[model samples]
Target: MTRRKLNMGKNNVYMKHWLSDKDRFADLINGSLYQGRQVFTAENMSVEDGEQGLVLRKTDGKEIAVQRYRDIMMKADDGTRIVVLACENQDEIHYAMPVREMLYDALSYVDQVNALRKNHRGKKDMKGWAEFLSGMKKMDLLSPVLNIVFYYGEDEWDGNLDLHGLLGLDRIDYRMLKKYVPNYRINLIDPKKLENLECFQTDLQIIFGMLKYRKNKEGMKNYVQNNRTFFAQVNQDTYNAVRAMLGSGQHLKTVNAKEGGTVNMCKALEDLYQDGVEEGIEKGLEKGIETGIIV
Candidate 1:
């Protein structure tokens, strides 16, 4: 098996660190994935370091050192029930994301099964090996693992959202094969597709709301102009992330340097709008002159 290096740029690195915070991570998951379920809390969440070692050996005796790292993994308890949660953050869309996510979930299940066998009281008995190895019965129930993909790309995700979607099958064949093939659907949280801003709480409301309008400069400007109070109350880290991700970092810095207070994104948006308008007019004028000369 060939090993691939995990390459992350400055923006992705910063985002990973930012999401590493338990509170912030929980807030995002609970708000977006759970939909106000409020089942997750910072106190209950714990980060799990991913697997690292020789995952496979080829027939040619070549060993492969592979690392599978998840962005976030934790167990959340709602007083009586506990569920395992894992999240993968993607800045870009992956076409084979469903398969990748399936692998992660499968690995987690394998680990859980191994742990069960190790802790079994009857391990010393001869029947223990048969029972554990045969996968006939289990002494304990495994917690359900929920895997989610948090996609933060500016453009819409065009990749397949489920295992079935990846299979190249005709409509008739797909219906026929449905019974034999197991389907796993990816839980994708895409900010660009979100419609209800009111569904979000805390910093996420602002983050997703801005992302929903990130491509529309005029829309963003209008949003900031109307919701000055909301923009003003944005935390510093979130402010920086939004401005940087939206290509307004320089403008934000200039405004902050001049005014020397809480960064007003509304003013920055106004400047960006004005700059865009001027640039458009200049291009239009140039095009008009060229057309006239040609005529």
Candidate 2:
């Protein structure tokens, strides 16, 4: 297999690692996706390293390598029912996210079936063999999997959220294609679209609040200033994530988070200022040369 480095920058890396934490992952799922229907603890969640190898055949019968990985997976039980929850974190919008998520769910079901077949083979009894031969009539139990995509990008997701949308069908062709293609929709969590900040219990409340008003500098500043106590209480990871999300240039210089000590927000701002100044000088020089040419 060919090894390639992922180009996800520091912000994306930070977000991925932050979401990998059990508590944060569970909180995000519960607060955002399920809407507190299923309360999941960190103990119930597990990080599924995104590394699955599969080969696909093209129309020419040439095989190509494909690997799949989910950001996090969790097994949750609400006493009567059990479920497998898979989450994918995206810093940017993927046009084929719905199909990608559907594929992931399908692969998980396939894994379950394979595991059941292996278990059936392990049974040496005549009854087990008989049941296995009968298409595993006794092993009908399978956990339902729920796939969710958490989108944290600054802009609105313009991608197709439903599989059917990618079919390139016209209005007239919709009826014809209805029976042939299945529609799979993505459960997208966009912090920017969140209307109620109270729904979130953890630091996500503050985080989402900031995201909602990210475009308005004065609004974001007011939010951070008003929630001084909350910022002071938030852990280092959350603090850092908030800083990163707000852009490296904007951060709370006064608030010293307890977990990772003091974060220097001013230094990043200074660097940004220097960059802007240099860019302005370059632009000025270019404009001067253009004027000289015109003369």
Candidate 3:
């Protein structure tokens, strides 16, 4: 696997802020995971505290904690069951993502079990020895958890996508072991690789579309110009995200956000394009003078 270290100066703050918005979060999940279906809505989903509290008790009474922090987490409860969705913003391709995600899901399940245990203890109900030790009733169920790694890096992901991908099963693993070994998969969302840009209903469409060419100044300028109707004005969050994703430039620094916290991406891109042209002309003259080619 090709692992590129994240730039020490770069961070995922902008991506976290962008994904924290419920509308954008739902759109991203639906578009990327659910075939563009409206599985989650801004109204139905409620943001939850993502601090991992699921812990294991020791014989000496000291709790062994598996603490983790998530960028954004949301929960939705229907009449039948509860569902949890967690987002982990990644600035680079995480080589051990499958195991990382597996732990998050496992901890969520353990938390659910703890909740069930507390409820049963409060009600003074325990049917058998199995329920008492397990911290859950026989019929008790756990909420399903889905963790997604939103990778917004400059390079393609070449790391393992699942637990099986990480294992060296080629030499010794037989079909018999497959039944005993449980495998886990990581849900990954790569905006640059998404083909269905229209699936997104928010500024995300513009964000994803622009991110695909973030490395190419010419392509980025063309993208903004082509989407001028929307790029002329974007909210502060989206603007900050675009600037962060594409990296800082002279023109980007010059464009002040509007009074109402909106930025003119169209104007910034145009100025940036103009800067490139002027630099090209100046550099050409410099080269010509150095070689005496223009004489």
Task: Write the residue-wise lDDT of candidate 2 on 121-187 in tens digits.
Answer: 6774326566766434474688888878877766678998888777764468576887777788899
* Candidate that would win on lDDT: 3
- CA lDDT of 82 in candidate 2? 69
Q: After superposing candidate 2 on the true structure, give the runs of residues whose Cα lies further than 4 Å from its correct spot.
A: 1-7, 54-65, 125-138, 247-295
Q: How many backbone clashes does candidate 1 have?
A: 0
| lDDT score, candidate 1, position 101 | 88
Ranking by TM-score: 3, 1, 2
| TM, every model | 0.76, 0.74, 0.87
Model 3: runs farther than 4 Å from truth?
Answer: 1-10, 54-63, 172-176, 247-259
Worst 10 residues of 3 by lDDT: 1-10
lDDT of 2 at 232: 41
Ranking by lDDT: 3, 1, 2
Q: Clash totals for all models, in order?
A: 0, 1, 0
